[model samples]
Target: MTGEVRRAETDVEREDAFAVRFEVFVEEQGVPEDLEVDGKDDEAVHFVGYAADESSDGSGSDADPRPVAAARLREVGDATGKVERVAVLEERRGDGWGRAIMEELEATAADRGLSTLTMHAQTPVEGFYRSLGYETTSDVFEEAGIPHVEMEKSLD
Candidate 1:
């Protein structure tokens, strides 16, 4: 539990974030690699939660921080934000890393003066988001063949 979550501020950090995303969505969830990484990454701000005691590649190298979870956010309107790519390593789930990523994204949203924050949360994880003050705003819908629902929160 000795980890810090922060925005992915470097290209290498961004890659690490994507690696976590790929591990969760593409490798474990059976999502296509091509579909897992949408082009929106270029315009989104990414966040990563790194465990100080864990190694991402299992090499145990201190030079590279192990990123356990990741998420991204982008402006959808003048006062609205969209969240995406929320993922955590299977081994890291339920350790608060996912919520850590969400908190960082929410702080970023509020910093940018966004009044509303929205996301397409996988149906199975809707309760997780709900615990963070997000409310389901739309009925279940399929995205990438997986059931999802739109959720939102007001930054005010």
Candidate 2:
């Protein structure tokens, strides 16, 4: 959270975001690559959070910030946007990167005139989303072989 979070504006930035997701979702959690790399990227606004204290990419450059967390926001109509693909490197958890990313996404949504945000959160992390003001709106369900619940937060 001490570093910076920015909307991905280049192919390389997007790739960095995806790399974090692949490490967390596909490699570490056993999610299939196909499911993790869904075709919606092109229509989403991706955000990448960087940490300057350490090198997440193994580049050994402490001075250069490296992507450590990522998430995407895509408008889903009725002035609401869906938050998706949230991921933080295993080493970066508990460092506030997840909250930082969500804050950035919420700020962007507000700037876009969105009145609410939604997400299908994995059950294990439902509490985390709730801490950010999201309320569960659905019973537990399965997605990508994991249990999940739909959650939403009003931006108004």
Candidate 3:
């Protein structure tokens, strides 16, 4: 997975990032449309992964522009960043795209002076986040009909 992950701050880029999440979570995972399309999008920092054309297997040209992964980072307070809506295309899973996105998100949060990062990870993926230095902070709860747990990590 030697692809580039781009951080998006502009409106168009954010929308494109959200679109990818919608496709994976809402459309494919059966998450309700409204629950997936939250109002926090506008205020969140988005990150996107584009399959590098240079790394294509020759099945398609590198000129094809497709977002294979995305994540959102929102400021929860003066020193906290909330990571949300992290999703990767089904076929792109297990290739490190998700971790890459989170790394970028943490860098962004640190750059913004945030010392702590938090997220509500779906139960099935909690271990994934935990492996990245996050620790569970709360009991599992239901979100959009899915089991999730709150996790946090300090970047200080």
Show where candidate 2 strays beyond 4 Å: 56-60
For model 3, what is the alpha-carbon lDDT of residue 133?
Answer: 98
Candidate 1 residue-wise lDDT, 1-156, digit = tens = 668899999998899899899989988999998898778898999998898877667776645669889999999897999999999989888888988889889999999999999999999999999999999999999988899999999989
Q: Each candidate: what lDDT?
A: 0.90, 0.92, 0.86
lDDT score, candidate 2: 0.92
**Which is the leading candidate under lDDT?**
2
lDDT of 2 by residue, 60-90 (tens): 5666678899999999998999999999999
lDDT (0-100) at residue 75 of candidate 3? 94
Worst 10 residues of 3 by lDDT: 53-62
Pick out the ten consecutive residues of candidate 1 with the lowest summed lDDT: 56-65
Identify the runs in model 1 with alpha carbons over 4 angstroms from their true place: 57-63
Model 3 Cα lDDT, one tens digit per residue, 1-156: 757788976676676688789889988989998888878777888898877643334454666556778998999897999999999988889988999999998999999999999999999999999999999999989988889999999998
